[model samples]
Target: IQLRAMIRWGLETVHRSLAPWCSVDSIARHLVEQTESLLLQLSDVRPLAPNKSALNHLLATAGWLTPPLVDGLQALGWLIDERGLAGTAATDGLAWCLPMHELFERWVEHLVRLWAYPFGGHVRSGRTFETLVPIRWSSAAPKSLKSLVPDVVVELGSQTWVFDAKYKNHFEELDDQAWFELAEEIQSEHRHDMHQALAYAATCPASQIITVLVYPMRLPVWERLTARGRSVTVAEVLGGDRSVQVALAGVPIQLSHPEQTNQIVAAWNPLFSVGQ
Candidate 1:
């Protein structure tokens, strides 16, 4: 119940923060999608029986509860309503809408709290790097290459770590060809992403370049790979365990979805740290 409340609070905060830039409808829809995903993931984990008193309290003053969870419930209710109103224009059609800056920012925050930092002690002082910073990577030459965007970027001591979010089931060992292909693709598009991070390391010249990939637990044991003199550590974020923390280049990277995050962070951490 406490965990649910905390999750609800985090979501509501995100919704409120994003409401200024995006419509309540759009935000509600996004929240609903995320909530459904979360619920589906948790379906296997037995939910603690709802406390009757708490249920009554929630029902009486649903408004008083945090906005994200309230918005989530509202979104769920809206989905139910939409199903009833199917075939009517009242239901918003599926569209790939560009998320507003505020919405994106809030989403990032929610992700950090709900997916990145689930363990209490992983983040010291409960601080996370701001999401609105104007960090840009050099344009990639090969247009076909996909530039990776890490979920969280952490600066620890003199190093900056890029943590990418991968919401996959688990980490699989990549063969040499696979790693080479991925590295080749990354180098082709955003040639400077790694270099820029290394340059940024001048100020905090990271001892390591970390990429934290977020993956769902319940697959296999996390694997660690070292290739081209770079190290990649794959860690698992079990669905049942909420508090999981791993270190990349000495910086603590915590994730609610540890399996994926660990792989990402591990892959990038060594790039900057090896020779430093």
Candidate 2:
């Protein structure tokens, strides 16, 4: 009954405390209206704690729909002076702010899974791909080799598509002339990203491997290049189905709106056609 509890909380909190024009009250009102009489049935239910830490943990672990409700509650808590309800007086005790980078990565993983599922591709996240190499000098000691865990890996037949979701906005990074001046120094991490994506392709256990460095960008773009005799490509995708070559590529994923998620899966369908 967490769902009912959430609806009840949002409904009651808005009614009790938030004015019509409060930052969150409008959203809360719309949510209550959408849920209709359902909240009335849960009159006896109590809402979750409005504490920032507790809500952040819940948002991280709860189902997709729950996070927004929890977020609304957080906003309500702050606007209506429920800081006392959080039971914390320290300034640092405020609600946690989830990192944008991690959220973007998760969103990309979701899109990858959605696109891969219908193509008979098994999509996995945080899959470790590793290889073994002998130590430089032999001794009575343990040996270790580094491993690669791409954000999303799609396995179809003997072909594997390795993907790393980078949260950095290449458009923003490259557009500013300041970044170009220190391009090598400021964008060293980008070079590392390219290296890592290619490394995954080279080391993966597949007859044919396609590596992609996926990032979020606001505009349409695509590029193909060869670095040290290896193929590297980049493309942007949004609300339309477009073909992306199934080789080394940097594909920009677009989620301009929540409703566009289905478009994302469709946009990348052409990737499966490649190497066929």
Candidate 3:
């Protein structure tokens, strides 16, 4: 119902904008036509007040809102309680936006896909799934298998690296003491992320499995831990590229930077020779 109203509002706003433009571009015409078609399909759905206004304002913005609208719908769906009201709708607007973790995961996946080209590899999106531990069995077990899928898997030759982007602030302060004195809940969450990454690594048949936990922080930091001969890492994607020597387990990966194209290519120069 809410989705239909949002789309209807969008269609109306676009129609209004396109009406004044005497020479409409191909893109604007297409958008207007598509929205009209969609509005017809959603004629039966009714709109809710207050929420509709908020959604309309969001959709009236300049940039594309398809992805954000989808995200908001998902948020609204999950947040509705037994009483049919979003638990946090009155308190915050999160119910009308994408979950932070999902947003981060998608952003990381996008960056990894772009970066994979330099490594002569392709980033496969959720192509691999690992069966859950203590696998549940039923008479129709063949039809059902509990599985876990990593966010992105980068394959280069025989090497398979699983990248899981976790949008968590796992550290309290930038000090060894802070890490050692982490709160119990935070420690538990970190341990869970590590276990999940290890699980993904174990599912890979490749001899060299690199499991990296990509986290967002204000500073660029890197940590490597090895358990049972497997490499587990926590990599912080920083705000800006402060240095050019960004290497992960001796394999260089570029971070966010404005003037990084030539430098990134130069950094990959060594890897190119090794690949040959």
Name the candidate that leads on lDDT.
2
lDDT of 2 by residue, 1-276 (tens): 664565566566545533332322244455556445655678778875345566567667867645567666565455345443222232432455668777777667766776786767887777333222123544666766444567788888877777777777653455445555755755788777766766566556676566777666552442111112112333432232322223333334443334455544555654665567
Instruction: Please give each candidate's TM-score.
Output: 0.29, 0.52, 0.44
Task: Give each model's whole-structure lDDT.
Answer: 0.38, 0.56, 0.51
Clashes of each: 27, 1, 0
Stretch of 10 with least lDDT, candidate 1:
118-127
Candidate 1 residue lDDT tens string, 132-238: 23444567643542332334565545434444333322233232245455655453533343343333323223443334443332322223233342334433223
lDDT of 3 by residue, 38-78 (tens): 76887887533226445446556626657866565434443
Candidate 3 or 1, higher TM-score: 3
Using TM-score as the measure, name the better of candidate 1 and candidate 2.
2
Checking candidate 2 for backbone clashes, the offending pairs are 233-250
